[model samples]
Target: MVGRGELTDAAWERIGPLLPGVDGRGRSWRDRRKAINGVSWGSRTGAPWRDLSERYGPWQTLCERFARREADRTWARLLEHVQVRDDFVGAGEWRVSVDSTINRAH
Candidate 1:
């Protein structure tokens, strides 16, 4: 497997299927994926949106999509659904750890 900073085509393939579908405007799923990925990539790389590559999507569009999703609770619902499915499917075991101690200062 390649290290970070490298774009694996599989990553794109995995995310491609999960993006929202286009409507009568005729936008492609690829475009939506690129926009979403672009914002994540920029944030991961610590780069300005203007520096984002076209292969992703327009920086403005990416930022806007992310913002809209955040405001609309789409991401929240997605996370909840993923957690529920993971629990049911046993994809990964969930472990909870709690620490109980009294601080000396208290």
Candidate 2:
């Protein structure tokens, strides 16, 4: 059951492999999807880390996971991947247009 601010299965499939230790040794960490969902919840709601819901497990763990990914530039790569997917689907052109009119100071 995906939570309110969680990625769907398809999305998780794309992102999960990019995270650490999916294929590594030692005891596996908690569910990556749930940890991501907790991070998403915290980001979307601006809630205090300590206030994370128990359903997502320890807040500290989630925060640390998020921090690790951020430090390693994983977040940027994930965004780029999603953007590429969007481009492939013909979602829209990636462009920006700006219009400006300036008046001379009197």
Give all candidates' CA lDDT scores: 0.65, 0.82
Whole-model lDDT, candidate 1? 0.65
**After superposition, candidate 2 runs with Cα above 4 Å error:** 22-27, 92-106
Per-residue alpha-carbon lDDT of model 1 for 1-106, expressed as tens digits? Answer: 5335544676556445554555454455455544655766786888877898877766777776777668867667666766776788888577897556543544
TM per model?
0.56, 0.75
Give model 1 RMSD, 1 decimal: 5.4
Candidate 2 residue-wise lDDT, 10-93, digit = tens: 888888987777434335676878888888899899999999999889888888778877988888998898899889999747
Q: Which stretches of candidate 1 lie over 4 Å from their true place?
A: 1-30, 43-46, 94-106
Question: Per-prediction RMSD in angstroms?
Answer: 5.4, 4.9
Q: Supply every candidate's count of residue pairs whose N, Cα or C atoms clash at under 3 angstroms.
A: 0, 0
